[model samples]
Target chain A: EAEVAQSPRYKITEKSQAVAFWCDPISGHATLYWYRQILGQGPELLVQFQDESVVDDSQLPKDRFSAERLKGVDSTLKIQPAELGDSAMYLCASSLPDSTGELFFGEGSRLTVL
Target chain B: AQSVTQLDSQVPVFEEAPVELRCNYSSSVSVYLFWYVQYPNQGLQLLLKYLSGSTLVKGINGFEAEFNKSQTSFHLRKPSVHISDTAEYFCAVSDPYQGGKLIFGQGTELSVKP
Candidate 1:
């Protein structure tokens, strides 16, 4: 079965350092999403992309976090000057252009800030 | 605006027992409902979805959910579960008008004890 792919399953960094996570969505998927999952809480959207264009990023903390799907197929999320609270699971999901709200997610990249 | 509410934070059930996870949503525009499951150290997976179909939707893993538009609820139910079913479940909503950005509710941890 085809699945979304994520790299560096785990990451640990010191506060004020930089961290990055990568994701490859299923082929032909036009919409991509980046979400943060805190321990014991649901995932929250950080950014969304429609192909190579951003659709929504209201919840994204632009001061420290940035995400881009340059080719609309794979995406990268970066957190500069990471804070302790930034330690969470970074999830990537994708859907087809005619998606009926169904999404396929990748095994998240776990971040631990010290 | 769109928001989701997952009533239970955790549900402990024994093997072969039935279980229900409640979810409610408030949305100004038409929206789609979904249920996602996340295993420990893993990413989220789509459990099921409701989008212009019969109110009762059946999904993988013998799970089903009913969409009550009047009550704005989408509750997931499973007649029997196994130890492998232990995981965190999340309820989410996506508004097409909002460019399909997903809004998620607090998760429910389902602990299926053997």
Candidate 2:
């Protein structure tokens, strides 16, 4: 079965440093999402992309976080000047354009800010 | 707007015992429901979904969920569980009209004791 791929399974950095996570969705998937999961909470949407265009990012903290799907196949989420509260699991998911709301998820990238 | 609520933050059950994780959602528009399981330090895996058709949807690992539209609930149930089933479960909703963006609940931790 095809699966979404994520890089940097673990990341540790200083509070003021920068951190980035990458994700590659399964082939032919046209929609991609980035979510943040706190220690005891469910994942929350950070950004969503449809092809190369962003569909929703209202919940994303643009002042310090940025995400891009340059070619609509792979995506990168960057958090500059990371904060201690930013430590969490970053998950990537993808789905077909006309999907009935099903999503395939990646293993995730865990970030720990000191 | 859509929001999901997972009734129990943690459920402890012995191995081979039946378990039920409650989930409810409030959405102004029609939406799809899903249950996902996440092992420690990992991303989520889809367990089942309710898009249309029969209200009872069966999924992997002998898990099933019934979508009760009138009550706005989609509760996950399993007749018997094992130690391996211990994990965090999430309930999510997606509005098809809003580009299928997912909104997840707080999550329920299922601790299947041996």
Clash list (residue pairs), candidate 2: none
Number of clashes in every candidate structure?
0, 0
What docking class should model 2 receive? medium
Stretches > 4 Å off in candidate 1: none
Sequence-dependent TM-score of model 1: 0.96
lDDT of 1 by residue, B1-114 (tens): 899999999999999999999999999888999999989999888899888869999999999999999999999999999999999999999987666677899999999998
Best by lDDT: 2
Global lDDT for candidate 1? 0.92
- RMSD in Å for model 2: 0.9
lDDT of 1 by residue, A2-114 (tens): 89999889999999999999999998999999999998888999998999999888899999999988877899999998999999999999988877778889999999999
TM-score between predicted and true chain B, model 1: 0.97
Q: Give me the overall lDDT of model 2.
A: 0.94
Q: Estimate the TM-score of every prediction.
A: 0.96, 0.98
